[model samples]
Target: MTDKAHVVIVGGGLAGLLLGCVVATTCRDRLSVTLIERALPEAPEESLDTRATAISRGSKALLDHWMLWEAVSNEAKPIEDIHVSRAARFGSAMLRDAQDAREPMGWVVENVLLQQVLVARCEAEGVALLEGREVVDFCATQENPKLTLNNEEVIDADLVVIADGAQSALRESIGIGAIRHSPSQFAIAVNCETDGADCGVAYERFTSEGPLALLPIPNGSSSRARYNVIWCAHKVKQAALLKLSDDDFIGALQAEFGWRAGKILRVGRRTGWPLGKIAARELVRARCVLFGNAAHTLHPVAGQGFNLSLRDVERLATVIATEAGQDAPFSSVERLSVFTDMSRKDHEQTMGATSQLAEMLDSPSPFVDGLASLALSTLDLTGPIKRNVAEFGMGRR
Candidate 1:
């Protein structure tokens, strides 16, 4: 019905909404974008998620370029340093910005706040918001991809983006298989307030039982040290953790994580979920492509999941914008292949690093654990190595 190429995105989670905003902002009037989401709007504070995500420097750069950084940073807390240690071990790694010394490595924002910002920006950019509707079926590889809603209404698109969750039926129906790489593990997330000064430092503690992470977060108008915790464990340990009282839980976490950031005075509600890695066997096919969790879902050991997805969004936006009005949108499998190839390195590197860390620390070999402890110490003392690791965490790679 219009000259602009039609691009239909299915899903409205953080990934889906952010992709819509980034693409709309990049292509402007050159593309017509529509988002099909099933969830209706809710009160801002009544969130579906209570967890927070770390945004790397590379991701911040993309948002900065797109002029959306301010909205996110307004509610984000900068992570100035990261402390890595092993439970009851001698060696530790204190990672700081020794390189370019640009801005803080990254920032942490609540998932709810981020969704609010992305949704607002998406609306402001004039992307058609076809919310409160579900796509019952989709055929994304045709000359003109088609989406059928629950109401049996059909819509055609020159290109289709699938940003649905990791368990995406649409991606499976379209013939994309996933490679899951993870052991039997689960994650428990909780927020806490500290009794000591927060030095804008995040912590990653590796224990014999599991790995635990604590990221800095905003504490409203108060100056108290607030944090979001991510604790990973096997089934039995996970069950034990969930069964503990709040006070006992804090005590157990304090014992595992130590007092580098001071005592864990109090904790908020806790959430738990099974953890794993899910990567699509193929990222693109003809006019169809996968984005966000639909393409890859990762372990939170390294806090790279959402940031990696944002990087993918930026790359796709630039590529799609470049080809707009010059080619038949994403109708070319070759063009989509270019995107896949260009993004492969980052994906492999990020996903590999996350998986390795989780598996390495969870190894049953005492020798490997000793070596990992030594590596942490060596990295801390080795200025160059520490700098490189810090930058990698900052998303420089």
Candidate 2:
């Protein structure tokens, strides 16, 4: 039994790793942290993470504060402008960084690279990262929380954080139910080469099928521009699109996305998964708390999923640090309540905005289409609306 408050994070994904790094660095003397991940963190040089994430400006600042931003800065592509339009629609809007000062709106980086950098930083901070271990059972109380791993290892902790993802067994075992909503959508993701120059522009084009986002990425030594494509489609169309050859898929994409960003010269391998919104009914339970996908999983329409999670990490870390500074135990109900109170508004707003945008945009009714077009046109003409949208997208508000 250690004198320090022990924290056991039950997941090694980006959110879990980030929380570990934050707490370990912020309250190292007062808190002992352990991260139990089923699989070890991948080596930095391993295969690139097929997925890419939009790191909002707020998230960037948090990463910078942790001293992890510089490590991945070279690979991150800044988005100077974002163009939003609907296919064959009369309304379109473009948000520029200049409108809200000259700061870049956000950055896009490969998932694997970010995780690798964070893992390295956590280890450097003396976080105990236990790989290939999973919690088979969990027992929580006001004073102590316990976990039983598959290897029959029973570990005790003062606090437990569940970030194991949407299908989180730990969250379920703790009697926390998730409110799930499936929009009958699937997102296809892939990397592609474009003929356009690297101008730090991103596109969010909506079509009859669903929303399509083309985010810029660091081209490195290559002269040609490159982008990561996220195209959401209904299940029926998704199956057909996934079966098409590379050339046919490119043709379909070009037809729907138009030639705004130049022609799609070549496309890399494509992968996809089902799209849905999953939010845990309760974010806090006694000495246990849910983080990241365990708390809420939103549609990728606005790229708010990871950004919201990063904000959660920042707030939770602040709460823990404040308590530790005062020599208060983090697992106490009072401290945990403070953490929840601080984060509730941000979580609710993010979840509400993301889900509402997804639902409104995906509606097939003509009334909805007309309303969306009007909204886009209004946003373009209204400075306050545009600024608010930009700020929200950048995770500033």
Best by TM-score: 1
Mind giving the per-residue lDDT tens digits that candidate 1 earns over 1-397? 5778988889998888888998898787799899989884453353223578899998888778878888878788899889898888778887888657868878998877787788888899988888888988887656798899998989998888988788998899889999986657889998888887977899898877668999998877556788889999997898899999989998999888888888888888788888877989998887788998999888898699888888888888877887686756676778778879989999999888888788787845978878887888889889888878887888887
114-200, model 2: which lDDT tens digit per residue? Answer: 888878888988888889888888887436788999999899887788999998998988799989886678999988888977888
Colliding residue pairs in candidate 2: none
After superposing candidate 1 on the true structure, give the runs of residues whose Cα lies further than 4 Å from its correct spot: 40-49, 99-102
Worst 10 residues of 1 by lDDT: 40-49
lDDT of 2: 0.84
Each prediction's Cα lDDT score?
0.84, 0.84
| Pairs clashing within candidate 1 | none
The window of 10 residues in a row where model 2 has the poorest summed lDDT is 41-50
Q: What are the RMSD figures for all models against the true structure? A: 2.2, 2.2
In terms of lDDT, model 1 sits at 0.84
